[model samples]
Target chain A: MVTLEDARRIIAAAEKKAAEIGQPMNIAVVDGGGNLVAHVRMDGAWIGSIDISIKKAWTSRAFDITTQDLATHSQSGGQFFGIHASNEGKVMVFAGGIPLKKDGKVVGGIGVSGGSGEQDSTVAQAGEAAF
Target chain B: MVTLEDARRIIAAAEKKAAEIGQPMNIAVVDGGGNLVAHVRMDGAWIGSIDISIKKAWTSRAFDITTQDLATHSQSGGQFFGIHASNEGKVMVFAGGIPLKKDGKVVGGIGVSGGSGEQDSTVAQAGEAAF
Candidate 1:
């Protein structure tokens, strides 16, 4: 049962991290069932950040692994190519996404876009720390 | 030249961030042309997260604004009304997307899904950082 307050805290933490790094970002948080909880888009953040952020969360929840790992595979010409198109409108074969878990159970996910991939990942790492 | 390697690196960094945060998400990366450069879909992300993520990336590329901002407007009944469908399979009204830029020029976009709008955004933010 991920509540709005929890999502808010996560967003707040993510925002703080972005500010610390001097990077503009857009962040998002979701629940166990893959539902939205909270979101924040910093001023000057790129517009596409919104999609990348959500996909990160979705990828995390779906694979139960960090989106980065999947990204690696995709680039290596592993299963990502075919897999990306497998789910139709439900799967994105890029990067910048992660999943949220509690007690070894996926409860939700998070994603971010803006800045370089490294910078984007940093902010997401900060949000996860908040939890 | 944003090669496939660049996209791969961005994806890797974003995934690392996701793992550190312990969140599950679906992530996507695009080139300056809004064409998919790299992507990764986690094992179990929700079906809808994929669309949300891509939309985020598209939103960023198209409007030069974060998907979160567009989401706010869409929800608030702002100016973009009907603008979502205006693109004909190019624009998404939902959350989770961002654009990629190089040297102040829009190069491409990214998107994520499978989490709350907030979570999705967070993952995208991470990708942006990598740039």
Candidate 2:
């Protein structure tokens, strides 16, 4: 159910990690239904990453898979080639999204952007750990 | 959280109003997360109206304002002139959408289409009344 409070906590942890890496990032969380719960764009984060962050969160929960993994299959000639064109172009098939699980079941998702894929993934992982 | 039942009720009311006005219409509802909950297209409704209806619902909730009012600020040279280009084209700055409120706090939105802006606004208002 990813209550707003829970989203805030996750975002806090993600923000901290982004800070540790000296990357201003955009972070977003989505509930079980792949609906946005909360989002934050750290000071100095790229404004363009705002929508990407939210879409990445949705992509994570929409498929219950990290967008990093989704990217592999969404590339040219891959199993999910052209998947990024789906969901009104809201499927962000790249790094920085991780599904939140409770009792080993996906309940929500977190997404981070505004940095290199690895940096984004690191912050997203921090957020997932919070959940 | 605008439950499915609530969306159904709102759509039903909007449909009735559209019928009364002799206008087949497209109606949509979205929850607090700006995610679609329900939608309906009456017989003879414009197919193009379907997407508009859904986008209107999402826009209302996303900005916590009526799309009719959004239209005002979104006009050329207006305060939000280029805002429609934001939100990945999900922002519909026109009539036909209204924010749903509970205890003065926005909880969801309803959108209607398939007629003039005034007609759509009327139908949307009826849906809002139901909530």
Clash count for each candidate, listed in order shown: 119, 0
Q: Per-residue alpha-carbon lDDT of model 2 for A5-95, expressed as tens digits?
A: 6887898899899999999888888778776665666756776787788888989999999999999998999999998888899999999
**After best superposition, candidate 2 residue B7: deviation in angstroms?**
31
Please give the distance, in angstroms, between residue B65's alpha carbon in candidate 2 and its true position after superposition: 12
Candidate 1 positional error at A35, Å = 1.6
Candidate 2's docking class is incorrect
lDDT of each: 0.67, 0.86
lDDT of 2 by residue, B26-123 (tens): 88887787766655666567768867898999999999999999999999999999999998898999999999999999999998888999999999
Q: Which residue pairs collide in model 2, if any?
A: none
Q: Which candidate has the top score in TM-score?
A: 2
lDDT string for model 1 (B1-131, tens) is: 45788777777766766666666677887766566777787767666666666656666775676777766654322322223432334666666777677888777777877677767677777877787
Residue A69 shift from truth in candidate 1, angstroms? 0.8
Model 1 steric clash total? 119
- What's model 1's lDDT at B100? 74
- Candidate 1 chain A: worst 10 consecutive residues by lDDT? A85-94
Off by over 4 Å in 1: B1-131
